[model samples]
Target: MDKTYLEINKQSWDEAAHRFFGRNPLPDYGPLAPSEDELNLFGDVTNLNVLEIGCGSGHSLRYMDQRNAGELWGLDLSKKQIEAAKTVLKNCHSPVHLFESPMEDNPGLPTNHFDIIFSIYALGWTTNLDKTFANVNQYLKKGGIFIFSWEHPIYNRVSNENSTLLFNKSYHEEGSYYHEAWSEPAVMQQYKISTYINTLINNGFKIERMIEDVRLTKEDIQRDSNRWYSYEKAKALPTSVIIKSQKL
Candidate 1:
């Protein structure tokens, strides 16, 4: 495992937790980057057990709670992020189970317990996608869903500072890359689309849907206006990718 890179990224998340939690209130189901409603991917989570991986400050968990999910669990690598999540869940009177651990660690979660396991813009930070997906498979019930979204591999290829669609690295490169999105440098892993799909298949998941979410309409750009890119820039590139799969 890339322990050093993971630690650096974890610290970055810990430091940004306060500001991120402040900006995003509980039950905020706005799209992570793509215009698609990720919540709808679950097709009605009412009375279903759900777990969210890398759930920063528990906003997404609280959203599941609001949808009347049977049980809610969230796991994160940053202690500070879990601390803020605890506060948010407490204030909302939500009985959410929160754990602080990397996705690869499994965090001693129960097997075949969750009806759905999901993440948004989080899995990209993981150093070992195979282990993470395998751990998720252990916790999810047979036929249960695994939904996640992350920075598109092609999108990550371009330089963030300028609109030039030039790649300093190969699209198939798999390692840590630093970005100045936060006060401290943030590290994320880049993998090709085939790698993601193959990893899911090896972990006993059947690909149900794969979406390369590009800027579609004026509303899409406006919805993502708060991001680092402008309307024209966003329109010129694919912003994110979402996958919805089921455990076999």
Candidate 2:
């Protein structure tokens, strides 16, 4: 029998996890998205409980620690990633808790607990968004904030050729796909933008802000245009989406 996508992803990360250490971390949300310094999303995090979903290598957890957050907690499906996070956060000033488990599972985290929960380019890995959102809703306090950033849904459906952007895939089609651009095959979900917002609303979250702006710097633009995700392509359209929601 074929292995599950979850299993495949985990296995792939188990081997290649070190390559992504501290990649696309906080202070900045994700690739080309605005910095928290500009957006100030989680202002004054001092002594506040924080949890991270898909916290790879504990880079964001380290950011939370630097902010003097009360409790630093994270969960990831890859065991090796969790180990790397443990090493990264072993000397944190605040309490650090790491769990190796799928975001789809309950993992027995305290309900209505976290003051702020965020995922950086991580939520897209979930096979079941409804279950994941339901779990996130269950874990957050009323009025607590949830911030996450991921590759824009439309970014998946478009490609650039000779400085021209072309829509090659159906934006309406939503499901799992094998993104072979990585060294390993990445089995991830592709959902319409509405699905994300509606799912959050359905799970009792009030959308605070939905930012689709491209915030690439001059240095980012100076990168080679022939690269997989060219700065020119990113400038043409939003490559990342950052959504801030509050549990209600």
Candidate 3:
């Protein structure tokens, strides 16, 4: 039987979680990469009901909780990632409802329950943007905010190894792209920026803010010379994009 994309991703992430947890301690927000804090995307989440789509060990969930967010919930496709999240939450005396499910499949979460639905570097893994956005719209309360971040479409246009910032792939190509450098091969969808905006608008979301985070400093490059995608390359292009929208 052929494996589904979700199944392949689950296997890869599960293995990654196992290996990652073995070597590292529970992660905080910034060290994973540059954070959304600089943008202040979800301002003052205090007492707001928030859901994270691809919560991955619940670091971001915990971060929100610490910021005094109310009724925190998280969803991830990988069981190992959920397990790691549970462990971290338990140690911190934080209670969070974590669900193991794909974002596109409607994971039995209550409709009109969340004031905010967000993800960081996760939604790109979703194969069906329309279904995913529609599902998110259902779970979010009317006028609730939906914020997410993903690898910039432009970043994928260049060869992963090239620091010269040359276009290796057309920006219009939307399909599965494989990462060969990881210990476990990983696959992610490449979509034009318009696809995300159009899908959200079609699903009843109004765009509030959109940011392309390409803030690379000289210190950042000098500090991480051994990095595979160096700061020089990142400085020349947008590395990630963050979108903040509201359900209309």
Candidate 4:
């Protein structure tokens, strides 16, 4: 079956939507709500406009709503997720705008318009980094914050390994990047780490914070059966990286 990353996300999210939204009113891969520490990532957003990509069930949306932010909006590729988010938003006092769009597609928000744009564990699935980040830049105000998190390259590499010490699948030896989907006729496409970073800088974003960690709990290991990736090795290498940047 011919499928894109968004399609895969939609399917998985649709199946898991109940479990996801049930666990938390708003759920993202990261913290349930934007805390003071997370707020630090964006300096100040008391009344600033916020845009979130891949906002599965409006976890961040509810958080921003509580803060009484100027305007809160979210975009995701999954209609089911959008529906789940709207249901959650019913209790929210602030207004929220939702849109269905893939990151590679134009999001239709005004350029230089948002105070913050953030995503978590979403960019890793993107087919085009340049187009994605470039479009993100178009929506941000000058000096706006862009905070996101992704599967750490190291973690991705290790996860592909059968063991922490050995690879389950071989990656390009020449440093070529690859994008892989979960479903049928699995094909991997070439990409590059440099391309991702360059895409940000080239799109007028400057990296301010880059945090990498292995970050698996004992439960996480048990849940995975400990045979998947070398969690022990991941202890030494990072499984994810959280980045805080600014539109310069």
Per lDDT, the best of the predicted structures is: 2
The parts of candidate 2 lying over 4 Å away from their true place are: 1-3, 222-226
Structural similarity to truth (TM-score) of each candidate:
0.88, 0.95, 0.87, 0.76
Q: Candidate 1's residue-wise lDDT over 1-248, tens digit each?
A: 78888789788888888887734232222233543353357777888989999888887787777778888898999999999888877854335788999988877799999999988778888889999999999999999999888767776566655545566678877766787677887878878889999999999999998876555567655554554545544567667778889999
Candidate that would win on TM-score: 2
lDDT of 3 by residue, 168-188 (tens): 878888878786657777878
Error of 2 at 71 (Å): 0.3
lDDT of 4 at 131: 77
Candidate 4 C-alpha lDDT tens digits along 1-248: 12464575566556656655633222223321222343466555678899888777787778778777778888887678789888877777766888887777776777888998888766765656777888888899898888887655544454433433555444443232433333322223233345567778998999887765443667545433234344566666655556778999
Task: State the number of backbone clashes in model 2.
Answer: 0
Better of 2 and 3 by lDDT: 2
Q: Which ranges in model 4 have alpha carbons more than 4 Å from their true place?
A: 1-12, 22-39, 159-164, 169-193, 214-233
List the candidates ranked by lDDT, beginning with the highest: 2, 1, 3, 4
**How does residue 10 of candidate 3 score in lDDT?**
86
lDDT of 2 by residue, 1-248 (tens): 12498898888778779888988799867666677888998989999999999999999999999989999999998999999999999999999888998898878799999999999999889989998999999999889999999989998688887878899998999988897767877788999889999999999999999999876677655532336557877888787899999999
The predicted structure with the larger lDDT, 1 or 4, is 1
For candidate 2, the lDDT comes to 0.87
